[model samples]
Target: MPGLSRRGERMPPSPIRKLVPLAEDAKRRGVRVHHVNIGQPDIESPEEFLEALRDPGTRIVPYGHSAGLWEYRDGLVEYYARFGIRVASDEIVVTTGGSEAIIFAFLALADPGDEVIVPEPFYTNYNGFAVEAGVTLVPVTCRIEDGFRLPPLSALETRITSRTRAILICNPNNPTGYVYSREELEALRDLVVERDLFLLSDEVYREFVFDGAAAHSVLHLEGIGDRGVLLDSISKRYSVCGARLGCLVTRNRDLLSAALRLGQARLCAPTLEQKAARRALDASPEYLEQVLDEYRARRDAVFEELAGIEGVLAVKPKGAFYTVVRLPVEDAEAFARWLLTDFQVEGETVMIAPAAGFYATPGLGRDEVRIAFVRKVPEMRRAMRILKLGLQAYRGAPARAGDRAGP
Candidate 1:
């Protein structure tokens, strides 16, 4: 048998999906499972998006321009402009998804051994993308005690080295749901300029901010265009995760050209999805406003329930749909696995993502788990109830067994 390549060996499994066999086994036993593990929303996609698919207007469904369909890119120009981000349609390169947009940035901006500094506990798939691009992710730790806000710019600067090529951030971040403030964005803009590094902003959760908190885009920073790359997707924005369409927005012609070549290598993004996404871009602002309301309700429901669980510590998430929670258990992965394997409340259990794989540094996040409150409010309440009960049972089981064995 042939040995696999080093890259394949180095790849890390997704913490979000690693416990599938246990969950499947539970379901096979006729147990109900509440998924708070991944960010698959239960919201309906906008009517316009559905309508476009119902009437695709085209027969052949041929490959679009490698950059994207002209109409789709044009629609994106209008979409970004609404957010006060000005860009030419030519400057956008549509990719397979935000996942590919990230890979494009890594390939275009950094050499194989180069480093990209990111806040710790970032989107987990970033690890996979880093392996694929052969670039390193250098993490600057952020504490849940501080609600996972970006650390002081000085703290970030300490991580910079001669091989550092860029700084990446997720506005309204994943796993922690920490939204970057305007001051933080300005600080990062200055740092990137002083360090001569590219700034990649993943703004996929732009509209999911809660509590009237604002999410400032790196593209909104003055004079940062040449140094900024905006990675965006319609997946979360329109509840269209199946669409598999996203774009890389930048004003750097050199980077844009490189991304185009990569896009060409892949041929093009999905044509039917692009057409549907173009219609999605035109969805009324009210559509997003209503969606935001739903997420806000879900957030409140989950946060309130978490607060009731003794030994559970989590700051209320300000944006996005997830929160990294510190659990009472010594090993969160074990606790999460036990929920699927041994425990159930009225034949229902919850699945969660352990937080260790979201970090690059060893031994971090061993007692933490990330929960995506993407279900509706009632469902989230039920999941949180199950989570609370699971924690109680898990913590008391050993003590109870020991007491029974004693005189």
Candidate 2:
């Protein structure tokens, strides 16, 4: 048999999905594993969108266009206009998902061995995309103590080289869930403009802002309009992850032209999903409001419960449904595995993604784990109970603690 290519060897398994076999093994042993690892929400998709999919009159399942249905793209333009982002349908190219948008953006704006500056502890899949695109990810450290704010603009300046092509941000970010304030967005705007670098904003969680927080878009910034790329998706907004609908929005004509070429190669994203996405674009504000409220309540419950556990530090997440908790354990990966394989409460255990995967730097996030508060309140409470007990048990083992928390 032939072996895989060098790129295949360089690629690592998705850290999020790497533990699936263990989770399945636990299930085989009759253990009810409460999954807090992934961000797939349990909320219902909008009824109007579902009805659109179920309509008997629906037809034309064939591929619509390389750039997606013209109607859906136009609807998305209107959707953004509501948020003060002015753009035409021509500026948007529908993608299979935001995942593809990221890849296409990199392919369009960067070359092999080029570099992109990203804040540390960002979405892990960015690393995978960087690897696939054959680009280097230049990371600037952002501490959780600071709520993962953009590291000082000066810190980012230090990482820039001639090869640095862009700066990627996930506003109201994943894992830490820190929403960038307008001031911070302006600071980034100034920096990107001064450096002449591309500003790629991943706004998939744009509608999930809590506590009356508003999301700032780089595309909304004045001078940076020609250099910014807005990655939008209907997955989180409509709780329809399987729809696989996303868009790449920009006023940069050259970038859009290049990205369109890439889109043409893939043919078109799903046709039916594009129609459903058009319906989603016109979904009721009340449906999204209710979903936001549910997520906020779950965030509060997780924060409060984690606070009660000694030696656990959890930042109050402002936008997304994830919380990064700093554990007292020596190695979070080992501890996470132990929770799934060795520890159980009432024949159940909590599954979480080790924070190390979220960072590009080696040895960082060693004592941390990213937990998604996606389950219902009752399930979240049960998972927290199991985690609290696991922490206590791990602390009691003298060899494990080694004088860190030993009696």
Candidate 3:
């Protein structure tokens, strides 16, 4: 048999989805599972998106321009302008998903063995993308006690080196929903300009901010067009995670040209989805406001429930649909696995993502879990109840590896 490359061997499994067999076995035994592990929202995808697919209009479902369909790119122009961002449609290169946009950004800006600094407890898939791009991730640790805010600029500067090519940030971050402020963006703008580095902002959750908080985009920084890459998606906004359509927007001529070549290699994003996304982009601001209200209610229910628990600790998230919870147990992965294999409350259990994988440094986030509030309020209430009981039972009896003790 042929062997795989070192890159293949080095790839780590997703913390969001590693324990499937045990979950399947639990279900086979008639035990219910409340899945809070991933970010798949229960909200409905926009009706306009579906209506766009009703008509083919063409004899052939053809490939679009590598830069993207003129109409779709034009729709994005209108979309960004609403956010106070000014950009030409020519500057946008539509990709397969936000996942691909991250890859393209790394490929365009960095050589092999280059570094990109990110705040710790970031999106877990970033590690996978970094490995594929042959770039190193330098983490600037942020404490949960501080609500995962960006560390001091001085702390971030200490992580920088000559090889550091970019700083990647997730606005209203995943795993830890810390929304960046205008002042923070200004600080990063100064840092990137002073250091001659690039700023890659993941703004997929731009419209999901809660508590009357607003998201500050790197593109909003004046005169930083030469050093800004905006990676965006309609997935979360419209609850169409399977759409697999996203784009990289930048005014940096060099970055734009290089990213276009990379986009050409992939050909183009899904044709039908692009059409649907165009309609999605045109959705009324009222539609988003109603959707946000639902998320805000669920967020409050989950946060309040967790707060009532004796040993569980978490800060109220200002944005996004997730929060990193500091659990009472030492090994959250073990606790997570145990919840599937051993514990059940009234024939039901909850699945959570262990937070360890969200950090690059060892032993960090060992006793934490990242929970997504993507489900309805009632389901969230039940999941939180199960979690409270699970923590109490697991703390009293820490399940050793291979121990399948029942709750």
Specify the poorest-scoring 10-residue window by lDDT in model 3: 398-407
lDDT on C-alpha atoms for all candidate structures:
0.91, 0.87, 0.90
Which portions of model 1 miss their true places by more than 4 Å?
A: 399-407
| True-vs-predicted CA distance for residue 86, candidate 2, Å | 1.1
How many clashes does the backbone of model 2 have? 0
Candidate numbers sorted by lDDT from highest down? 1, 3, 2
Using all chains and alpha carbons, the TM-scores for the candidates as numbered come to 0.97, 0.97, 0.97
Predicted structure 1, TM vs. truth:
0.97
Over the stretch 92-143, how does candidate 1's per-residue lDDT look in tens digits? 9999989999999999999999999999988999999999999999999998
**Off by more than 4 A, model 2:** 56-60, 398-407
How high is the lDDT of residue 294 in model 2? Answer: 94
Clash pairs (backbone) in predicted model 3: none
Candidate 3, position 357, lDDT: 93
TM-score of 2: 0.97
